[model samples]
Target: MNTTLQQAFGNIDIYLFDQLLKGRFDSCRNVLDAGCGGGRNLLYFLQNGFEVYGVDLHEQAIQNVQHLAQQLAPQLPPDYFQVAPVEDMPFPDNTFDLVICSAVLHFARDEAHFDAMVRSLWRVLAPGGYLLARLASTIGIEDRVESLGRGRYYLPDGSERYLVDEQTLLSYTQELGGELFEPIKTTNVQNLRCMTTWCAQKL
Candidate 1:
């Protein structure tokens, strides 16, 4: 619940935290947090000398990120943070060496919307860049999910989400010509819902 941009990472997705532990970003200097949502995933990047950029559809979130950047990394341009949707970002292609999209894709309205959001993120990812995404999925709890068609599902937690299955993820990874940096893994939260961690490298 701590969304503050402190020197210490607070409330980052566990999958992203694992990548940090594995040094997946050790050599990367330019990082982007798409759907940054209060900059919970950006603390480490700001404090570690990385050129951090973030985008969110919410104006307040963007402002918060800009303030955090100005405070922790004054050298970075104030425009590094912007109010933009993941489906239509303003950055040029191949601009980021690392991109994080946590809990964002599940908000997709439909199939095309999902593809648009993913492609927008992928378009900005530099070759050999790493992409870390954590989103809702029906991977292990397929039987428990109520299908709403076009990738949307009603979860046991009573929320609706655009849930992906293993096959869908693999298909998209192939479509993007990306290689798996880590096998697809899902965590079921006591039948309430399932979240999947997907890590890949652009080939």
Candidate 2:
């Protein structure tokens, strides 16, 4: 395997990188990074010939990703990136083969917000597509979080964030008629915060 192309994947989440190693995305030609921030998780996809698209609420973030696309995959159209909130995406239904929502769903204002974002992403995923999300969760350290109400919590890291647990994720997966492609795995960051990697295939 040629690895020189992968070195450009700077600081990507380890769990996501693991999926890349497993060839989970090899058959998916169209990809979306729902809350792509500066395209850190997309370098390999762009350089390796996948039709990459991205959306971010911040216009600057979209611009940065567009710049990256231009430099790495100049053959793509400029409109492949957009500035839009994840709660409601502009794309039509079943638009992508793979959707990535890394470190983004944790910013949801409440349960409603989280669902809206997730649904929007799901609505754009074609049947048999995949959704991969990494978000802050209270799974392992439930007692360590202080509920701030409305699905938000003050984590041990002194930050207030919207967190989910295993049950919530599993319920959503079922409600969406999706099946887990991998087990729900959470990483505990020295009791400060926990991040869960949830990967599922839309049925």
Candidate 3:
């Protein structure tokens, strides 16, 4: 990665970077990163004057994000970041224009937990808002994973995750009353694990 680019983007997910390139979030002002880990996906937004907030279960992660914000977006108050779970974010209803949950959903203990987190993310999103997520899925490596019951699976990579399939994601999109902002896409890493990008806009 170029030094200049790294300073600007700070390890943003490539798919999310693609969305940035496409101007998918050009009109979005308030952004919330649910389950933010060290604010890896937030550098660009913070630097560009977006009203950015974040929440994480880990206290250390929240502290790290606050430090990152202080360095890049000094105007933002420290309280903008909180230590909270994705399943129960502390924000008011329909507050943010963009909700980002990257590489976090796969840690769900079960289908119910996953649903709870998704609903929380949706609840805080304003009308016509975008929800961007990346999570482990059984899309391309369906045969390479063993079901552990309750939507959990043991992947060939020797890691366990609550993996969703293409149909499941599409069904959820419909259930959430959201339209696909972009076609659902997945990247397979050496057939070890598959990560899917689900970008949807609330109708």
Candidate 4:
């Protein structure tokens, strides 16, 4: 059977974390692959020596990973995953050493939902743990204006996104008691239309 685009997206995380953030992996352990579609990222983290756990709202995602694990000869290392939404995670407070909500926050339906997601992520973070979030920050002003909706932005990909600005992100993390890192500018000038990201460390 052919894999889906969602599966390919999960595989892309392996590339992003391994390549984009490879130098910074030293700060993470007991990682949570939040919005972990298909569990490919948990496998990536496991291979990189992190004790990982993954969670997603889709049961199909969990089943996909389970199938992948069952097919592997060498036990896929130590990892656990569950089905749950971002606003309400199943794990206890301060459960993860690193929480990655990559490309997921924009789905929040409203301000309250968005606030809850930030709070939930912070609550499960161990002191000094990091939360890395990437969003649709690369869209142009014309694009944003044309796609405005009920308190959010609609992307052409049929993915509802919240057009978050850099200052807004910094304010949330700072108010929540995190030490925010400087933006990592894209090294390639040609890829200027890249998502803006923030790495906040819980204090």
lDDT of each: 0.90, 0.92, 0.95, 0.66
Worst-scoring 10-residue span by lDDT in model 1: 1-10
Q: How accurate is candidate 3 locally (lDDT)?
A: 0.95
For every model shown, the clashing-pair count is 0, 0, 0, 0
1-203, model 2: which lDDT tens digit per residue?
A: 34654566766878878999899989998999999989999988988899999989889999999999999899999898999898778789988999999999999999899989988989999999999999999988999999999999999899999999999999999999999999999999999999999998999
Most TM-score-accurate candidate: 3
TM-score of 3: 0.98
- Model 2 clashes, total count: 0
Tens-place lDDT digits, model 3, residues 160-186: 999999998899899989999999999
TM-score of each: 0.95, 0.96, 0.98, 0.76
Q: Which ranking of candidates, highest TM-score first?
A: 3, 2, 1, 4
Distance from true location, Cα of 180 in model 2, Å: 0.2
Candidate 2: segments with Cα more than 4 A from true spot: 1-6
Can you write out model 1's per-residue Cα lDDT over 1-203, one digit (the tens) per residue? 34453337876777888888898789897999999988889988888799999999999998998998888899999898998899899999988999999999999999999999999989999999998899999988889999999889999999999999998889889999998999999999998899998888999
lDDT leader = 3
The window of 10 residues in a row where model 2 has the poorest summed lDDT is 1-10
Query: Which pairs of residues collide in candidate 1?
Result: none
Winner on TM-score (1 vs 2) = 2
Task: Itemize residue pairs with steric clashes in candidate 4.
Answer: none
